[model samples]
Target: MTGWTEYTLALVAFTASHFVPRIGDLRGRLIGRVGRRAYFSVYGLLSLALLVWVIVAAGRAPFVEVWPQAPWMRWAPNLLMPLAAVLIVNGIGIAQPFTLGGRRQAVFDPADPGFAAISRHPLFLALALWSLAHLVPNGDLAHVILFGLFAALALAAIPIFDARAQAHFGPDTAPAFFRATGLFSLAPLANRSWRKRNGGRLVKRTAIGIILWAALLLGHTAVIGVSPLP
Candidate 1:
């Protein structure tokens, strides 16, 4: 249907919008033109607009079934969602040199790297979890496109981040950072208790995550007109 076409366009636009801007000097040039703060402000607003369009278009697209919804499907998010949220909260809450403007903060420890004890790229991990958690139960063409794209991009980012780190931090610091961090679930390497070091932030962010997830549970029907709860 016509909505399928719209959904496809929206998906393509969403991917291109984020990627194209950052390809070369385009983003830097834009930042120079508009000033960094204004550029980010505009970028944020534009990205939000694109996201809304994708969601709206996906909602309207005629359902093209893939697999029949499994009875056990809803449980996937229930189990993994909190972990994803926690990772994201812990990841971004710290100053990660990989993120935009974060290198300026100089918070990435060659020794610890905070939650990088679990994974060097916790934000990417969180995103992949979030994408896959929602995508599996979705089982529709439009949503498959949307969430699959995100999951692929997030997973791909892990390696990309590593490469960027090596380049940016140089041969010495980067190698030590990589040695300290694990590609996945390196909690075994954690030298001390993370809970002790960042207990307050952990409690606060997890509580906020719970509140947000609860709101999504209650309001998914209202917002998307589909009950996430089976």
Candidate 2:
């Protein structure tokens, strides 16, 4: 299929994946109408199907250069990928209470340190970073569309998810969530705080980052049939 055809299909899948979650808000009514488990099962399956379709479409689409590739940008992804990976790992390891997906506790504790001090949604931020890093290097019609859509989704979802969380959890929870996890979303500004929390763990984050960088460098050519560094 043509890149345009693939792009269109990807857009549809992406839109469905994002918009489907919003319907969960109607749970009370929907669950009342349909069985609760049935509603969730259907929604989960639909979301999974859409996600798989988008990934498949993205993989099939050929890269069509939209702009001149810069030598510097080639190096940038190599640098950023590691940071993105660390954020991803931190998100996985940390028990951030502020994020919609983070673990919820009965009591709030300020001393609860983790990736929360860096960003409320480190995982989401990592995804955004990874998308941006790849988009910069790919700078092609298909990649531009795919990564651009992903970047926009990652960014837009944060606020939307935060709002939904506040609505569901109450106004009091929003402030703490914002305070704890907001920093991770913006790395440069959170450096001081991240250093304090991570301290000796910075070495661990760096090691994880290097592993991620190497994995991407090695895998990009095989997976995409193009060496991003070259």
Candidate 3:
């Protein structure tokens, strides 16, 4: 198959991998059979593999320029990625069960909602940020298609996840969860109620985010064959 064909297939497979399991009780049935740990391990590996394929295929696809590359384009990812890294650092394995990356065993406290207070779907927001930032620099048909799908999916997932959570938690408990969380907002940082609760964890996560951002910037050329620096 041609590069574009491969890229298309990879994108379809990646999308399906995320959506198919959510159809009816397929995910629950799989978890029942293999146990949650094994099911998620396999699912994670598959998703990672598909994501790498889509990325590589996009590079291989014919570069049809949609817009001229500019030095300013490179600044988008550089500026946004640190925030994305921090969101990933804090959102992963967190107690918020309202969205993706929440730990099943952890209990979510509505009063002290932590990062969820800033965004209930922090990981998805991070994914959207990463996608949009990269999209600004690429300015090519293949990569535009690639990053556009991711950005759209990440944004769309927030409401879908919220609806699902509301359904799962029912009318009583869902109000408190919804009240404490925002879809994506920086106003929480300025708000005294949320500011007092987030405290040390925010600092710790930001430190980790800075380290991760530095590592990614350093490795960008090695991994992607292009320097992220403008």
- Candidate 2, residues 72-157, lDDT tens digits: the string is 88876777777887777666645754453466452434455555666667767877888888888777777787788778878887
Judging by lDDT, tell me the better candidate of 2 and 3: 3
- Best-to-worst order by TM-score is 3, 1, 2
lDDT of each: 0.76, 0.69, 0.90
Better of 1 and 2 by TM-score: 1
RMSD of each: 2.5, 4.8, 1.8
Q: Better model by TM-score, 1 or 3?
A: 3
lDDT of 3 at 124: 94
Q: Which candidate model has the greater TM-score, 2 or 3? A: 3
Residue by residue across 175-196, what tens digits does model 1's lDDT show? 7877766766646434356656
- Show where candidate 3 strays beyond 4 Å: 187-197
Displacement of residue 17 (Cα, Å) in model 3 is: 0.9
Clashing pairs in 3: none
Model 2, stretches more than 4 Å misplaced? 24-56, 59-65, 97-101, 104-108, 164-177, 185-206
Q: Cα deviation in Å at residue 36, candidate 3?
A: 0.5
Worst 10 residues of 3 by lDDT: 191-200
Best by TM-score: 3
Q: What is the lDDT of residue 148 in candidate 3?
A: 96
